[model samples]
Target: MYYTIGEVANATGIAISTLRYYDREGMFPDMERSSGGIRVFSDKELGTLKVVECLKHAGMSIKDIKEFLGWCQEGDATLPQRRRMFHDRLAEVERQMDELRNTMNLLRYKCWYYDTAVAAGTEDAVRDLPDEDVPEDLRDYRI
Candidate 1:
């Protein structure tokens, strides 16, 4: 079924402005316009937007997603490129997950340290640290 831009935005929880921006970026070249020239979206277009949301949630840049769409439009000629993109994104996601796990461990350790210091009445043992002491593994996990 077809849907208006507003409807699609409401259903997907994506801002209508962002959907329009994606359309302008050639992510949905087959998108139709209504008789009054408002954007009209097909189910396929909505599906594409959902994929875009997933990619964004995975920390992908708009440029990378645009390139992916370009390769998608070129069909089999860019299948290898598409595969490589997917592989890269997968590797990045795995690294992010590892870092998050490490960070959680560090935070737990820090909390335990603080609790023990308080219980033992030994503030010096709390080991005040610069934020940088958070290991390299978790440094780049900022949201």
Candidate 2:
């Protein structure tokens, strides 16, 4: 079934203007237009929009995404290049995940620090605790 641009926007949770900009940027190369110049989107196009959203969330630049879309249009001949692109993206994502995990660990340590301080009614009390009493994962963060 075909959907109007407004319908596509509602379904995808993307702003209508952004979707229009994507169309203008050649992100929707296979999109159809009515004789009267209205854009027509198919259900299949919704899946394409989901991929665009995922790639954008993964930190791909619009120009790079456009290039990837162009590669997509080239069919199986571009499979190796597309695989490498995804592999590179995967590496970046893994690096981001590692950074986030480190941040989370620090946050957890701070939470424990504050909680201990609250229990003792003074930050100094928690700060005086021995290193052996600290969680191993948080030992490096000890006061």
Candidate 3:
């Protein structure tokens, strides 16, 4: 079934103007228009919107996504380029995950340090802890 622009915007959590912008950018190359030239989104358009959003969230630029879409239209001949692009995205995501993990580790260590200092009634107890005195898991995780 076809849905109006409002329904598509609501379902996709995208602003109507952004949808129009995506259309202007040729993001939805095959999306339909009604007799009145109103946008009418079908499941295909919805699925494509979801994909565009995912790629955007994953650090792919609109230009790269447009290129990716063009690659799709080129059929199996472009498969290697698409695969390489995704592999690059995966590496970047992995780097981001590692940075987050390090941040969490620092936060965890801070929590432990504060808890120890609070119990001792002063920061003195934890401020200059020796390497051997710190918890093994937190020893290397200080700020």
Q: Report the number of the highest-lDDT candidate.
A: 3
lDDT of 2 by residue, 1-143 (tens): 99999998887789999999999998888899999999999876787888889999899999999999999999999999999999999999999999999888888889999998899899988777888888888987654
Clashing pairs in 2: none
Among residues 3 or more apart in sequence or in different chains, the pairs in candidate 1 whose N, CA or C atoms overlap within 3 Å are none
Best by TM-score: 2
| Candidates sorted by TM-score, best first | 2, 3, 1
Error of 1 at 14 (Å): 1.3
lDDT of each: 0.81, 0.90, 0.91
Deviating ranges (above 4 Å) for candidate 3:
none
Sorted on lDDT, best first, the list reads: 3, 2, 1
- Tens digit per residue, CA lDDT, model 3, 1-45: 999989988887899999999999988888889999998888988
The per-residue C-alpha lDDT of model 1 at residue 33 equals: 92
> All candidates' TM-scores?
0.78, 0.91, 0.90
Cα-lDDT of candidate 3: 0.91
